[model samples]
Target: MERQRFDSHQEHPPAWISGYHLVYIQEGEGIMRVDGDPLLLKSGKVVLLKPDCCIEMEVRSGKPLFLYDFSFTYTMISDKPRQAEKVALSTGHHMLSAKAAVQLSLLLEQLEQRQGIEEPLAQWKQSILFQECMHLVLSDPVSSEETGGTREAIEKVLLYLQEHYRGDISLKEVAHMHGISASNFSGVFKKHVGLNPLDYVTQLRIAQAQRKLKASQPIELVAREVGFKDPLYFSRIFKRTVGVTPSIYRKHRHTDKIITLLPHLNDYLLALEVKPFATLPYGGNDHINGYLPYLARELQETKLTGSWNKPDMDELVEAQPGLILGSNWFPINLETVKKIAPTIPIILRDDWQSLLLDFARFFGKGDEWKLWMRRYEQKVMQAKSLLSLSHSSRESVMILTVTCSEYRVYGGRRQLGKVLYEDLQLTPPAGITTKAHYVCVNLEQIQAMNPDHIFLTTNNSNPSKEQIKNLKETKAWSSLRAVQKNQVYEVESWLNGHAPIKHSLSIDVAIDHLAANRQKPWEAIGM
Candidate 1:
């Protein structure tokens, strides 16, 4: 047994195993890819690796990994009288209980101490400790569940296929690993995972290809990224699966039948003048069929596809959408959704301007974004001119979001904060010093800053109504200069969404309240 400590974010070179190996994670967490299948490495978790397996280990960033590694050959006593035969153990991972892990560590320590001791008594003691360690491994309930049943084995194979599908995977080699014929394994895997091994691989590859295409990546490069060698063949397969040519799909010119799994993504589709075929509700209640009041007019004809968390799959199927846009936060299963239509998981950033540009470029609406930005800049200039008369640039503005339970103060980086501090070029309260997104504060902290203006809003409507009412009754709230001057503007709570439509609407609302101007030319164009 060797104690191995790997540095943070370190990736070990790929090594082929000559004997059976077991790794007991002593501290930290990471991933170990065995024959191209990833296994999560965490504290108290043990992994068994079989002979001839290729393995690579990677530690997560800022987290150093420590493991107790044991490698040996195995000989089992057979049921036959006085017979011993070599046997191979299965490859899988199991979580060890805290008590069992501690006992195993003690046994390993004793065995390590006995290493290199050539005396007969020392060798005998080492053998006993090794046997005790093996007993602890074999007796583990989770380990037995991982390696004992055919169903469990098939599940592991499914996960392996899901991770390595982009690589060149062979049905014969996969079947051989399970000690079965290719035909038999295919039938069993199809029964369990709902698709044959090869078909499942194709589905995974094509799903990834659709995401790359949406990002405006080159067809040739996208092909190579998803395991396709020939760009022409990739295009043909893409057309066959997606019902449009690759170029047309990338340009987003073929269909308007798009489904947005998240509500704010609807704002992006609308800004591009592409009405979504279906969308999820905006607020918490799934049964309410709620849409953001600002976006309701544009989405009136669009179908409501239930909640984002648990979308009605039948509604999605009936829509016959050519594409589905979603984010990582959506709880719907990606594989199941991909079966209905091509789904792209969006990576969201805090900057709404960049997100708008990304969406515009994705849908071949760069000219539209440029046109919209011109109108937006015109509106910003007008609003800034009006603000210059009523307020100075050095005066502080605070965006305080009240929920039922807490208060969150936004700095210059947040959506609403960008409109006030960045777009309008106003100042943030002295209390908000960090570069983090938003900071949770108490009433005492709010009283200390005493900004010139305060934009008060709830995270969502109804829940914080009483909270806001009670807050206004406080002495600290009544003593503020902004409160005395009637500068506490209660704006729409839905301004929390980070989207182009939200940004435009926020500016309109801010100008309306702060400068007493109701002009909404920027919002008019999108509507």
Candidate 2:
């Protein structure tokens, strides 16, 4: 598949194009008259045109509009006409879903990076990625009847169930949530999802229980935490799902303990390298964004250092840092590092949960990891307990930041985004997709949303004092309540000052700063 963006106001080819053309609107607004049928285009929306379709587009935006266009071809071969029919039915060609858009963007980025590379290795990697894209296009269910309104409903229910798996939810409650009779809901859900409601609930509970167990929790407590009322029944379900008793599963899960020396630490014996493990935030430059603080706390609780990036290699050679955790993207020269600290170990952490597991094993704190995880579960419960609390009469306020020139507005899903929604309970405006870890929104769109507070992420290196003063003086910015009231604030980049672990502290400070200006100062607001 080939992906590119077009922004020509002049007319181009009038001839029909072969293969599928999927276009996502990135900015501005326009209309494409396809075969004399007008199709409106707006930001965040995607349109898919089939092969050999006549097309003419007219854009009306003041500035150039951006569209992400993907083109691909597929061959259909079959035993008979029926085979061709089957191939046509099975081939994936549909409008890009919001989730698919995020994935495609990631793939396109990788492909762009290798566009000029000449190595055979680069060619092989590109070929593999192209094949994967083809597979994704052909396997997506959007073109099938299986993915209809009922399927969408099932997806929503599944999401809700997954998010609230720890809570006491029943089939009747789920049915009522969707405003359907229990029997009808159960039949339709089964037909579309291939699992009965009760069975689905049981599977979700069991999966969560397994995660808890793997973290080294006691089986009985894990069972109750997952909503299993009876320990014996939970054991039966666990054995049926995993082919082993809970206790046996836990005992055998730790069978592997292969510790390899980091490319930088080959000189020391494995036994001599036994020291506390520490992890830095995945991205070295923190800027107080994402789940770094939570991950850091987990690391510290497990007796690991929260400051992995600032490790003193010379001191570590003597003190022995059993393992230093980093991400796969770090730019360290591992060979040189190993020569310097041969006695220390190194581990890479890709996600929050995996980091927890690595800490558990390295510190011999497997059991403690389980206990802390349980406490996390309890904290979640306490947060949900406020569902019945009276809603506040105060107006809601949101903090938005614009760092890069793209004028992107951060959304939930990025560390800062997720904290804003899940932790601080702020609601983002509609028509925004969770594609960009920090969303890129145009200035006009930001004004349209009209958030109460606009907290800009500024580096001293950028937006020099003069630029900052000019921006504050702009007519458009001056109209904003935040700008008018001087609510704008600057946060340092992680390495420069705002390290990942310090983000929570920064957020707390920002909240207090905002609260001090609010009319209702008594409202609770803290990280």
Candidate 3:
């Protein structure tokens, strides 16, 4: 970064650079030529120059143009070291957010302050701030909303291919499913997914083939398994895509590090005793994120990728994942993530166990999944037995969290609800048994249910203890049977404990805590 002020009518010849050049139009206005196009440079507008794009300048009518020029190379998630054009910097020009500009200025100031300093902590702070500034610069709120539909259409196509890719398919047939013409779907799919329909399917086939070949399966059988009727054609595509024949690739098979993006996927990976190279955060604090907090000691070393749905491309590239496991919960850009490695999206449905099994099968761990399911069943049964021994069969349990003082009863098929309502055979109180996502209950609504036991977790959203004390003083609270009986057990809500393994551990912890806290049957354990 350097500051320069040019006099009026000053003309500079075109120049090419090796990195992006962003000029913060501090004052005045001019015409900056970019890519042979004359872009009107003005105050409050950032002038972005791509690496190869030439910039010819002529100060137009105004005071001398004073600007801060920032030149930096972006090694972020691009397929190649190209100039950043897609992010708020292409076409004519775009408005920079005042907040973002201020943030960048602060970061730059910090960086300048630490130029000669040797403190590692100071340097790390500057680095993080600089990265954050870059992220903010890349962030333009308008594009995310506009591209949302585009992302969905592409995802729908991808899912269709996933479900039916093993059979003979064509572009028209798939496009018909989405009610779009072949030509339009082809263009949209390529634009968003970076591959035409035929190419995508062929790549999908090749990816599946690679796995089967690695298992030393027969070339012909593998071809049939991945949807190729003609083994000869399959072999040709395989060699082209993988750069090797099936038999040769199989002989050189080696395990590659898998990157699991969703928190549950990370826990699911850990359940098989296989550590991921990196994963997304299950929880902000290690304690609240996943089921096996104990195993977090091993996982704490893993990198927490940038965002959930749309992770930072640069981070994905750096991880160098052999396989990427993600969920459909986020707006994950399939085309971009695939550039780093083969990316697979797992749809998180009500059937989390089924999701786990799917992952297991992908990793060739079907047998392990079955074994885990058996042990999981055993664990559930044990927890159920212990819980049944505590409260009467007629007694009910309520699972809820206090979010900003309102009680959000966990309904629907979420993991915590499943563990309490289904796995433990614990009947929910009258209102919570149905299929609603969550019933927002005020103090009166909370008091109305008045169950035998209440299992409450604050999660990270609840009010402070002082606020709870105020709630307890209300007539609505004192009238509750659980509160009067001292059965309002405050438990940890494992935010990341949505996976089978994590849910199992969470179930045990809940039961143990419930058994220990209640005065009736398990007071023996509590004290």
Whole-model lDDT, model 1: 0.75
TM-score of each: 0.52, 0.35, 0.50
**Top model number, lDDT:** 1
121, model 2: CA deviation in Å?
Answer: 77
Best by TM-score: 1
Question: Worst 10-residue stretch by lDDT in candidate 1?
Answer: 518-527
lDDT of each: 0.75, 0.50, 0.65
The C-alpha stretches of model 1 lying farther than 4 A from their native spots are: 1-253, 284-289, 516-527
lDDT of 1 by residue, 236-277 (tens): 887766555678677654467888888888887787787888
Residue by residue across 1-527, what tens digits does model 3's lDDT show? 67678777666777777677767675565767666655555544555566766677778543477677778765435656655444533523454554454445445555556665668997787667666755665574435622455544565677678668899897887788776667688887786556888898887787678667767889999999999999999878776665446654565334456777776667677766567777765553334344235556767767677654447678888877777776687677777777787666777777778777655645545445655674565455546556666653458778767655566777646667777776766778878864555677787777778888877776553353446667778888889998888878776655424677667766655666565333222221111
The TM-score, computed over Cα atoms with residue i paired to residue i, of candidate 2 is: 0.35
Clashes per model (N, Cα, C within 3 A): 0, 8, 1
lDDT rank order: 1, 3, 2
Better of 1 and 2 by TM-score: 1
RMSD of each: 21.1, 26.2, 26.1
